[model samples]
Target: MSRRKKRRKQEEEHMDESWLVPYADILTLLLALFIVLFAASSIDAQKFQQIASSFNNVLDGGSSIMEYQAPKQPELESLPIVEEEKKPLEEKSDKQKDKEELEELQRKINKYIKQNKLDDALQTKLTEEGLLVTLQDGALFDSASAKVRAEDAELAREISELLVLNPPRKIIISGHTDNVPINNHEFESNWHLSVMRSVNFMKILLENEKLNPSYFSARGLGEYEPIATNETVEGRAKNRRVEILILPHADLQP
Candidate 1:
């Protein structure tokens, strides 16, 4: 055979049989697959939550986290702590409500006094301690006498009516006397007169069963705690009076 023909035959016989096309196709598919896998695995928890939420929207109406085992029921003793936690909140709410209620009550009393044209005879005040209703001695009693005057008895009845509706947290019926010392037959001293006055006034209030005697208390300042100086007759008249301090129950710190 000719050398050229022999070389041609050898070339044909030794031609490369590599499967490059199939191998390239497989490599490309594997690369694409790995890219898809990386994208799926690299998703953040936020994305996961969003996906779960979306899926839940389409199917069962709950998130994937809901499927996780719920926390075990707390121990029975721990339940008490739950109640304890709620107690202070409830107490605070009650205190706030009570304060508002007392304020409303004060407003009502003032309105009643103003409507009835008793503004001159009575004055309602909101003090740091509580509400105070100061009834001047001349308006409610005879001069230097423990007896509740006939005209003043009507005022007392009116006040008692209001108190019956909304009783004082503690009705401290304090009686005050002028600086002038008392040396009368019925009363030995101003102190005695002051105390007797308070006692007598409290007795009148307690006559109404609606007014709780347990909550009612009486005291005699006896020229002390004067609202005005005793330098003048008018000032002494102002000083000689009965003050009903409606202490708020919420403010009872003790």
Candidate 2:
């Protein structure tokens, strides 16, 4: 064989083997990736985290010798706190205001009663119905007659004036009689006498210009509602009376 032929034969026999090193390295990396994936599936959370962190460190930077600072995030102000709006307090009702005014009037009436010293004849009481101003039969009228006495007229006038209110209230003048049978000229029975007495008393009250006549009323309960027993003289006298009821509620007219 010639020398050139021998050289060509030797080159062909010893083909290029440098690619096997890189191929072997690629196979090793693939095997390592498969092993890591299998391990991740089976390993606990903590162990997996640790392994992942170690792998990242090895892949990114093998050593912690160099110090690097992350970009400082812009300083953020705390979110503004928003508060709720508060509501105003509630005002009093019309009924409540009326009640207060009525109470004040009662005090004034009580003071007048105390100063005048008419405890026996004129009596005042506060009740659920209204303020009741009770007058004895003798104080208001003479026996068997519905007319008020001349001397006591001044007292009746004063009471009528006192009844005059800014916002007028319902005024009911009621007359009552004892359990006595009567058949006379002026009065047919006790019922007639009581009715006339209430009407006469209301007429005197209506004389006050300041008071509203529409609010005034007159009624007679002849021997029906008696506070005391009518068997004795004193009890019968007590039973005969007149009541001036001042109602504060506008809804209750009578």
Q: Among these predicted structures, which one has the highest lDDT? A: 2
Q: What tens-digit string does per-residue lDDT give for candidate 2 at 1-254?
A: 99999999888767665335465445544654554576754566765665555545545645321122222334789976443322111123555666677788888887778889988888878777888888998998999999998888888888887898887889899999999987888888888888989999888888878888999899999899898999999999988999999997765323
How well does candidate 2 score on lDDT at residue 250?
A: 69
Q: Give the lowest summed-lDDT range of ten residues in model 1.
A: 64-73
Give the Å shift of residue 244 in candidate 2: 0.5
lDDT on C-alpha atoms for all candidate structures: 0.72, 0.78
Number of clashing pairs, model 1?
Answer: 0
Model 2 Cα shift for residue 106 (angstroms): 1.8
- 36 Cα displacement, candidate 2 (Å): 30
- Displacement of residue 194 (Cα, Å) in model 2 is 0.7
